[model samples]
Target chain A: MIVGDRKPMDEILEMLEPYENILILGCGTCVTVCLSGGEREAAILAGQLRIWGKKEGKNLNIMEHTIQRQCEKEWVDEMRGHVEKADVVLSLACGVGVQLVAEMYEEKAIYPGLNTTFMGYPVVHGTWLENCRGCGNCVLAHTGGVCPITRCAKSLLNGPCGGSQDGKCEISKDTECAWQVIYERLKKKDQLDWMNSYQPPRDWSTAGDGGPRKSVKIEEVID
Target chain B: MEADEATSTSEVPEEFRPRIVAYCCNYCAYAAADLAGSMRLSYPPDVKVIRLPCSGKVEISYLLKALEEGADGVMVAGCMEGDCHFMEGNFRAKRKVRHAKRLLEEIGFDSQRLEMFNLSSAMAGRFAEIILEMTERIKKLGPTPLRKGVKD
Candidate 1:
């Protein structure tokens, strides 16, 4: 999932200053899974903002609602009625979810409440670490399930860069060498042979060709 | 463990009884605690029970906020491992508890302070025992530094 974390409260407040009626839209999927923009988070942020709004004596109407998946058009479309009534939308979803909201409602303003980190998992409760760059291509097959692109300090496709010292990355003592982790993981799985093959630099087209992008999205195409 | 650092709540509990918080699944753990009440089983009142529809509904931040407010110890009580009013509620709750334990430890709070338990709704005695155990553990640890003046 595309991992994200909330932006500073001041930033959010700044964005909402122009609008009178606001909606704090949340996602129930990936961002929710990573504990970023979810129903619970939406409620909490709403409560907090309301308290802040009251202290400032500003007449702010902040409504909180969560969708099943903000990335999906169908889910976003459900809010058309709600969206039309609000002056601006404060999306708690990831970056994609924000874009989708923007796409869904062209006339209204949409703002992001999260800083859309990298794709990661919950290392533990409330803790998230970046794992995937979502370069549009996945290379998990060669790296023994670990993605050096995201986990490695250098995003090295090859084995540990010489910066590793005593199994730790030179970038930081606390961080483990991604290549070493791959080595051990591959060894455990008896897939070290996969590492012997060489790979060239990753293609950037899938990452940032920097143009209007479109996907086939076969499932969404109805007869 | 990461949640503590992430939520920035761990540092808030610098001292005191370390307000203990528990999220109890209304179907199981809450009922168990009620059973303890009926049975007259005694446990410390420092721990506050926040009833949840299911442990699954309790988010990581919910627990973090509790700890930030000086909850010295936290626990999530759910239905038995195999039985949940909402399938996998306890399972997810357990995962959350484990993650919370790690987060608390990462923030300098003892990981033991956050715990997860699975019990049948009928097992009230077990609930009292768990509460007593958690209270004793927190008492030994003393007040959480953050809780010394947490806003609540």
Candidate 2:
């Protein structure tokens, strides 16, 4: 899932200074799973803001609402009433959700409340680790299930670089060497020969660096 | 309830009396408070106790909302370490309190205004002492920065 973190309160307060009626919009999908921008998070932000407003003696009326998925137009439409009532919206969704809302509400001021971090999942109860680069390609079939593109500090294709030492990445002792894990997995499966297949330089076009990426379900689209 | 309005009708002196919200876990701290009451022990009246099933159940929103509603200080009192009736409820509350403290600091509020305490149901004297400690600390800190001048 897409992981995100809430922006600093000082930044949020500064952006909200000019607005009176503010709506804290939360996404119920990715951000929710990451424990950053869910309905509870929306209420938490609203509570903080209300305290700030009262302290500053500002007449700020804060409202909070969350939708199933902010990137979907149907879910975004459900917030039309709330969007119309607020002078500004602080969207606690990923960059995609923020843009979709901005595109739909051209006349309203839409702001991002979270910094979209990466495609990842919680590695522990409260810890999340990025494991995908969204390269628009799947290399897991060749390498073990480990993603060297994200886990490796250098994103090495044929890793266990000189920096890897004792199963730990050179960058941080806390980070396990991705190649080491991959080597072990492949060795266990007797597929160590796969590592000999040197992968060529990646084509950048498929990655986000080329441009905005999209997918169209030809059969599902009508018109 | 409006704490300020509720206090306005009291006969207490006009000095700055900080309003404090104390979240007491029913399994321990609440019972300790009851024991304190039965023993005729005296503590500051400024501290209002809100009983919860477990301190673990205290959400970060509850602590922030208390401050938002004009609480000068907030504290969560639960069972001592390894003594929680719900196994790890007090432990969870301790972590939540720490998290709430960080959030409070981020908002530019004094994190000292919030605290967590560990107690057993038999610690009646300690319960009163905790209230006095919090009340004195809040009094020294004066009203919450959020409640300094806003007329609710």
Candidate 3:
């Protein structure tokens, strides 16, 4: 899932200084799963903001709302009434959700409450690790399912670099060399021959190189 | 004027008593509190214990809510490391406690007001000690300024 972390409270408070009626909007999808932006988080932030405002002698009218998915137009539309009531909208969603909300409400001011980190999964209860870069290419078939693009420090396509030492990457002892993992897995599967083949340079066009990427299904469009 | 001055000199300042909310795991800290009671151990009466099924169930929102609702201090008491009945609930709770403490500090409150304690159900004496320690620390810090009508 797309992972994100809430922006620092100081920055959020500063952005909210000029606004009195604030709407803290939360997303119910990926941001919620990552425990960054959810209904509970929205409420907590609202409460904290109120306390801070009271301390500063600034009276604030804060409202909390969480929609199904902010990235989708339908979900963004559902929050129109709340947006109208708010002087400013503090979006506690991923970057995509924040942008979508901004696009949907061009006349209203919107501020992101979270820093969208990466596409990753939680390794443990509260720890998340980045596992994919979304390069718009799948190279796992040739590398024994290990992502060299993200896991490797150099994004090596062929084999291990000189920095790989005893299965560990030079970046840190905690990080395993992606090539070493691929080599070991391929060796176990008796498919070591795949390692002998050389891979060409990766294409950048499909990976949002030229501009923002979009996907559309012509048949599914109602119009 | 002499009589008025004498009466004013005799007046004593009211002691500051902190209101603390402790979220205790039922398997460990809650049971320890009960044990402390059964053993007749003395601790501060300022702490109000709210028992939960596990320490991991203590959410950050709950901690913040306690402070927002007039709690001067908050604590999460869980089992010792690696001894949780739910395997890693205590560990998870510890991380959440640390995060919540940071949040509290950012919100202009004393981070020391929130703490995490690890103890076993059998350690009744230790439970009493922890309560006293927390109370003394809070006394030194004085009442929370976030409390309504409190002066800095």
Candidate 4:
């Protein structure tokens, strides 16, 4: 899942200051899983704004709602009536959910409440970190099931560079050189010979070469 | 309480009472309180009950708003184990209570004041006991310092 955290509440208030009435939308899918932009969070944000606005005598009328999956058009349309009446929408969803809501309501000003971090898993309660870069390639079989490209600081294909003395990476005392992992893994598999065989340079065209990328299947469109 | 945001706590009389919005389920806690009253048992007059269909409908945001509006604390009382008027409403209420505790803790609250209690309607005395207990607890914790001293 893509991990994210809510933007500061101060920043959110600044963006929504112009609007007296606002509808805050929450997503029930990935954002809910990460516990960033969910129904509970949406309501909490709305309540906070109301209290603050009232304290400042700012006539801020706010309401909150959550959809099953704001990333889908079907789910986004469910709150059409609520969205139409509000002066603005504050989305408590991931980057994708924010975009989906914005695209659905072209005229409404949709603001994001989170900064999307990366593709990863929840390590434990309230802790999430990046684990995959989704380079559109899979070389886990060649290495020790760890992608050196993402984990390694140098992205060394076959390494244990001269700087690496112990098991840790040369760049930092904390990090384990991914090449060390690869060496140990290949050694365990009795396939150390594969290490000597130079791997061709990584194909840059397939990996982050252009600007932003997209993953889509025209055939799989909303079936 | 003082949702007006203008009435300063310092300006109020010590005897000035706090208003609490209690969401009590009809099955157990609400009836339990009524039984206490009918039986001439005394309890604090701070709470104003909002009879809810179930404790499950008590969102944490409501609790937060109660506190934000200057209620000393909010207590959610549900049915005793497996005795809900609506099956599993109290169970869902239990989950909401735990989640609310976590949220309040994250936002720098001790969360002891915001609480959930479970009891059967037969335990009217116990319901009265919990209200007294929670109310006393909040009184000791003092007014929510965040909402206090607003420089008028």
By the lDDT metric, which is better: model 1 or model 2?
2
Q: Please, what are the lDDT tens digits per residue for candidate 1 over residues B1-152?
A: 23432344433345434467889999998998888889888876677898999988887767766654456677888999879999998989888778666544433455776788888888988988888888777666555445433365
Query: Which stretches in model 1 have alpha-carbon errors above 4 Å?
Result: A210-213, A217-223, B1-152
Task: Provide the global lDDT of candidate 1 against the true structure.
Answer: 0.79
- Position A94, candidate 4: lDDT: 84
True contacts kept of each: 0.00, 0.69, 0.48, 0.24
Q: Give the higher-DockQ candidate: 2 or 4.
A: 2
- Return the top candidate by DockQ: 2
- Per-residue lDDT tens digits of candidate 3, residues A138-188? 898999888899889899998799999999999999999999999999999
Task: Report the lDDT tens digits of candidate 4 across residue range B79-147.
Answer: 887778788999888887887776655444557657888987778789778878877776655555445
Candidate 2 displacement at residue A116 in angstroms:
0.5
Candidate 4 per-residue lDDT over residues A1-223, each given as its tens digit? 7677888766887889799889998888888888888888888877667656654556677989999987889989989999998999999888888998999999999999888887777767677756678887777778867678877887777776886768888788977777887889889998888778877887766677797777889899896
**lDDT of each residue in A100-173, candidate 2, tens digit only:** 99999999999999999999988898899999998888789878898988888898888889998999999999
Instruction: Give the RMSD in angstroms, all C-alphas superposed, for model 3.
Output: 5.7
Evaluated at residue B76, the lDDT of candidate 4 is 89
Ordered from best to worst TM-score, the candidate numbers read: 2, 3, 4, 1
Computed on alpha carbons, the lDDT of every model, listed in order, comes to 0.79, 0.89, 0.87, 0.77
Interface RMSD of the predictions, in order shown? 9.5, 5.1, 7.5, 5.7
Which candidate number would show the highest lDDT if scored against the true structure?
A: 2
Sorted by lDDT (best first), the order is 2, 3, 1, 4
Give model 1's TM-score for chain A to 2 decimal places.
0.90
Per-residue error for A179 in candidate 2, Å, reads: 0.7
